[model samples]
Target: MREVAFITQNKEKWLNFEQAIFHRRFKDPDELATLYIHIINDLSYAQTYYPKSRVIAYLNQLAAKAFQSIYRTRRQDTNRLLYFFRTEVPLTVYQHRRYFAYAFTLFFIFVAIGVVSAAHDDTFVRLILGDGYVNMTLDNIKNGDPVAVYKSGSNWGSFIGITLNNIYVSMRAFVYGIFGGLGTGWILLQNGIMLGAFQYMFHAEGVLWESVRGIWIHGAMEIFSIVVTGAAGFILGAGILFPKTYSRKTSFKMAFKDGIRILLSTIPFFIAAGFLEGFVTRYAGVMPDMAALIIILGTLGFISYYYLIYPFIIHRKTVNSL
Candidate 1:
């Protein structure tokens, strides 16, 4: 592609990205993600497709300037949340897959920790879960209803509480990026170990599959939200660790902004997960087999669609456009 042609082809997208970043009251996640993808693609194309061209150098400079502009002033409004969901969240998921090795290593470490601790001492549950929560859960278990903790509160109240709590957890996960992302990894490790230990306890009680079917209805989304949160933290931390051409502060600021944007996108997912856990999870025994299956499958579908399918579609569309 010639310089003028390439510039013309992307002119509309660039303009939209600029206006969305500056003029619009709120930026759309879809638009913002699209812009991000475009800028990266432009740079990649310039470096690979026309490395020696003066146009390549000029475009690189242009992209750098544009990135700086957006970095300086992050316009957040109502559309901010919407754009985050449509673009930011999906991209985070996609980006995290590149670190599947890290995630798997963490998973194995947490699982081993749970197994080793459980095998060595019966009090491992207390270590994994706080003493107070463990005692409360044990009491609940002894009361002839192990899952009674999920049975409290009306549906609406539970929905609000769970959603808010989950979002708070996610935001905290992102905030931990300030520690150069080690804090983020700790959050993931802690959560993963708790999950492993919690499930192991259920297994000891001879209700592993039952708990899986019931709890995972919401956990699928809830856990995925955490993974995305961790990914966002990693992005921030990665920027801090490897600033490339930008100054440490500039890169860190940009990463933090993008990370939070990704975090913002997951609010609805957390709310839905909370609702499922609070309302639907309580009625696992009463919920029809088909309905339960549908909910579980639906949650999986949402995750797969956003994380895997949508990213592929967007990548192909952008590449084909160029």
Candidate 2:
């Protein structure tokens, strides 16, 4: 990015800030403060890249004027929980959205490896899924219900067990980032391979459709949450790998906090996934096709919207709100 290009790109925003500050175009300090943060960021960039640039003085002037307006009308925000989900997560996720793409790309590659391996090798699925589980599923398939495994436990018992396991898996993805995200990638590889192998086994047995409704009744959100948490893990690792302007220790602390918040955001979705797996998936084999499809699509849509699409929407709204 050349200095001229940078100035050209940000000129409109700078002009907006200038008008807001000099002409009293914005009385709301919250909005002005938000604009101030943008100006300060640009000032920092100008100072770093072009130490003697005239743009720094202009940005500094805008920042200094906005500072007084901020404190004069600043009000404490009371709805911490609401803000965390509604504003904080969206902004943070948007900032690191590329990590999600990385995680998902890895997920697809690993899953494809699993599928190809299982397709070519008769025993590869068993190697990944283990003999006992494979044999049990085969037995269920023979009995005309390929997914009868879901019916083994009481609903509440299964829900509690599955939810705990999900939370544990999510935290593992986050904690493993201490190892520079390789640990999280390893976890994703293992799980992705297993999922691919599991699905292919049913396809090879001519029960792919039977498995789809039952498995995806909950797997939609469950799988999405895992990938998301894995992205959080990468975010955690990135702080250590590329600390940029901050010290490594400070970066680690910041990434850890942000990663934990991202992990926390997945809990409700995990619980919902667990509830579906325990209570709904067990009946998917017997439920009406329309009903099963609705649940599957609904869960998938809701989770996908939140993690994939909503972040950008919120980000655009926040930036354009100025």
Candidate 3:
């Protein structure tokens, strides 16, 4: 069937299913389960025949919602927390993939801006990274240990401090969405610029590779989590900016629900990043090149797959199994 015809045929049923799930006044677990089966059947058909159509994604969202509602009416046979992390977060992240794209795009663009600006203006690095940090790093470079900053604090103290600071940064990235996402964008811009300038400073001092080996040991997870948090912020902002078919208040509430879930998913990642920064990144300069490379790629690959790739896998598997 043509995509348009398929959507036209099932669209009303999908909308009704959505309404039935959203309104608590009319919830019936058994009845919703019946409707959910129908929705999944349609979703599987859409997946097989209309694989490229947006309808697949739309149906997937409905299927997820319906499944949540149906489960709400029943006792859990499985661990709810495991199900939430393993399934729910991935599905919701898939639905908001565009926000991820937007956040990363803005961050990279600003990073480029920082690189270019700093390359031409020596003072730009000082301005973004602060004079004290610039001076300290320069001194460390002279001492033949550019990453010595990470070694200054005790490992346990650094891990605790870094983890707390990471959480604070992520919360700000998420909470700023109330201003319509621009605040989150600003945070991304600032961080991106600082990163770019900081790296360029190393390059100018003939230690680009030296810096990468140590910095990326933990920088991989730390930076990726921030970008993901920024996406969550965008999700929050999107609700306020585009309240289609729902009141502004209702839309904001829905956005907050999903946004917070996205934020919650990053907690473990932030902790991992902090541990690496405190205990590992400091030794990047002296550690074996192969070992440092593994840590960097391993952390980067793990988080990237979770947020960027795993969602489709779970969503597709859930739809097809039904």
Candidate 4:
């Protein structure tokens, strides 16, 4: 097709992709994949037909972004891979995938510092959780109701309340990125450190295994959502930091919109996690070990298939059909 003919024919598609990537919700994985193809085609066409055009160069950069999204979604395959992707790689991408090595290096260094400090100091968890919470938890444990905090209400009521609250927290974290991304960074740091400290507290009490079996039934998905929310915040903050071709204001707006959409996508995950925490975790004392194991394994299995296995299957099927 002639350059203009292709441009004219794809004008709608181009606009759709542009809006989806820069404006629409990020949850519709299919739209994201479709946009990837459109962007790749547009950039290749521009290079072939209008190499010197500034417009072509700009679109090419956006196309690169589309490709990176594909890579991010693609890596979320196996449970092991999904664990890494959901927890680690997405955060790195938030900082710019190009800097993943540096970001991870710094992350591990900080984690090590946290681990070492906690190892030496019995008071580290207190510092992280605060004396009030430690005392409250100790009081609960002494009363023969270690996890009573989660068992205080009707299961369904707690489920709805907690789910809604978690979603709001995640959305706020993303929206707060308007404060020049510091808000997002602070949220991530505080949560990450608290998680580590929480785990350490259980370990110190010689209940780490019990804690993992009981808590991760819900914590796995809930915590993953938190990380993804952080990614959304990063997306918003990134626009402000590196506007690249567009005016800073325009880039910031685009990023903020996308970030909100990313946060919106986590609603269902939060709901499910909340249900498990409220109903299931609260009854861990009476629930079968096999049931909790199944729940944890099943959730991880779903994440593995949707993110990692499905993509490879699609790619291979397409190759074979061709």
Candidate 5:
């Protein structure tokens, strides 16, 4: 493109970025960094395509200003934790919202497959859930407490163990993106299938409502975190599979950073799930039906709103402000 055309095309965006920096309109450091990257790319193009033009010098000056704005040290905010949850995570989620959709679609499809297979084959639940688990659950059902397995351990011990296990699972889902997301998909498939078969087993035994009331208190958060981690894996994998405007190395580095943040965001939810499972799920058999429903639905609603709805709300506000 001609120098004039290039300048005309990007001038408005550059001006907006300048206003964002000078007026302090950016939502967070991440947004500033993103703008800086764009500025750097524009500067590179100017140098390469219009080296002798005044636009090159102008872009260099603009890029330098943006760099300083982004990297300059400022007093650390005391409310860093609040800022992260309120701004950083939601912005990142908004940016990669489609990956969340992809993860959910893949998981649901696997769940459907599991449900169909289990319905067709009597041994399917055992295969998916493992013979030992199926047998133990069968014994529990015979003894009149199908979910009694949750009551096996001390509450605090179970909480710690389950929380640690969930963290490990999420990390695996994230790190396995090094395999370009197949590993993460495998993890999701395994979990989704097990969930489907397990639910089917309870339904076949005529205790679907009982099982849901007992399991979903914690399962809501746990399952949602799993799906989010799957999305994180896909974000990482996409860095390799589809680098778009960036080099593969650059894309992967960016993806890894964002993926880490996304994975970290799930820790609290996992802990909450652990607490519910360790304490609440054990009493699910005795808990009032209405109370159980409230817990399950409330947890589900919180996860859905935070991960799915809040991001879009933040995005819209940010865009409108810009």
Candidate 6:
């Protein structure tokens, strides 16, 4: 690229970085690091092609300033928790939003397959959910309470156990990314199929709406968190599979960090789901329909906004600001 053309093309971006640094406008470390990476790439290009030009010197100085700024700001944030939820996670989500879509698509497809299979074969639900569970649920349904299984456990014990199990499942989903994402896909498929078949069982028993009111009260957040964790796994797998301009190690490291951040973001939601399952779901039978709808739709809307809509809004705002 010609020096003049290069400068012209990137002048606005460079100026935005300058303004951000000088005015202390950067909102997060990730944003600053992103700008620093772009500046360093430009610096490398300038040094290679404009060896004798003033642009090389200019880029070097700019790069130095960015490095110093990033370094100086690199301290343990006292509000690390707040900053992570407010900025870091959202930005990371925005950057890898496509992976979220991929995960959801894979899960939905698996769910459809499960529904169709269960519809055709009476034994399919039992196979996926295990014969023991299927028998227990059948007993519960015959006893006039299909979701009575949820009500059997002590509330606090159930909360603690469910929370731990959810965290474990999420961690498993994330760690399985080491198998090049196939493991993550398997996890999603298993869970999605189980869910579809479970719902179908209720439908077959003529209690589909009753099951929805009870199950989805907590399942909304629980299922969505699982899907998000799957996306995290794919993010890590993609780093190993397609390193792009980065070396495999570097790409994997970056992916691992981002994936961990994304995975961490789901923890709170998992806990909430657990709480709902332990405390609220037990009362699903007696709870007013409006109350159940509020919990179910509210959880769905919140997760959808944060994971899906808010990320896009944040990305657009960041771009516009730049």
TM-score of each: 0.71, 0.81, 0.86, 0.66, 0.80, 0.79
The models' CA-based lDDT, in order, is 0.70, 0.85, 0.86, 0.66, 0.84, 0.85
Judging by TM-score against the true structure, name the best candidate: 3
| Clashes in predicted model 5 | 0
Candidate 1: deviation at residue 233, Å?
A: 0.7
Least accurate 10 contiguous residues by lDDT in model 1: 64-73
Report the CA-based lDDT of candidate 5 relative to the real structure: 0.84
lDDT tens per residue, model 6, 269-314 = 9999999999999999898999999999999999999999887675
Tens digits of lDDT, candidate 1, 86-156: 54555444444554346446756876788667666788888878899878867866665666677788888
Best-fitting candidate, scored by lDDT: 3
Q: Tell me, what's the RMSD of every candidate?
A: 7.5, 7.0, 3.7, 9.2, 7.4, 7.6
Least well predicted 10-residue stretch by lDDT in candidate 5: 67-76
- lDDT (10s digit) by residue, model 5, range 90-155: 777876788899999999998888889899999999887889999999989889898989999899
Give the clashing residue pairs of candidate 6, or none: none
lDDT of 1: 0.70
Lowest-sum lDDT 10-residue window in model 6: 63-72
Higher-scoring candidate on lDDT, 1 or 5: 5
Q: How well does model 2 score by local distance difference test?
A: 0.85
Which 10-residue window in model 2 sums to the lowest lDDT?
Answer: 67-76
Pairs of residues clashing in candidate 4: 76-307, 76-308, 77-308
Give the per-residue lDDT digits (tens) of candidate 3, residues 198-285. 9999999999888999999999999999999999999999999987656899889988998999999999999999999988887777
Candidate with better TM-score, 1 vs 6? 6
The residue-by-residue lDDT of candidate 4 on 16-110, one tens digit each, is 77666656546765668767666667777778888876657567556645544544455545676444434333332332432223323333444
